[model samples]
Target: MLILFGWRTTIEQLRMLSLVCGHCHNQAAHHLFRRRTKPTIFFIPLFTISSRYGLQCTFCGVSYDISKADALQLGAHV
Candidate 1:
């Protein structure tokens, strides 16, 4: 039997906010994202392997990790 399996990472944009970046200290738009890694078999997703949340600054392109609760709150648009 031929078995193909791999892990895939999906990044979803949650929301956009105007805030001051901690790294660049510039007032700019930031994008919140939810990143999920899932195991796939035969190109079909089976289950999630890991998950992460990130907040990225548009101008500085700096990314910061955030809590899942905060990501859920920011992603209320769903």
Candidate 2:
């Protein structure tokens, strides 16, 4: 018998916030997402091994890796 195991990362959009893009210099909507990497057994997610976050621009479609504090600050609606 053979067993297949591996690691996989799942990305999910958690929220949307209005922010200005530095590269494009445009005030537009941005999306915040959560990345969870888990161990997979036979193509089934077993447990989360690591977690991360990111931000993506809605207009230019540029993505960025950001810290938790920065993500919260940028997520503020004003």
Specify the highest-lDDT model's number.
Answer: 1
- Candidate 1 minimal-lDDT segment of 10 residues: 69-78
lDDT of candidates 1 onward, in order = 0.88, 0.83
TM-score of each: 0.87, 0.85
Q: Number of clashing residue pairs in every model?
A: 0, 0
lDDT by residue for model 1 (1-78), tens: 999989989998888988899999999999998889999999999888788888999999999999888877775343
CA lDDT of 27 in candidate 2? 97
Q: Write the per-residue lDDT of candidate 2 for residues 1-78, one digit (tens) a residue.
A: 999999999888878988899879899998888788999989999988887788899999999888777767766321
lDDT of 1: 0.88
Residue 48 shift from truth in candidate 2, angstroms: 1.0
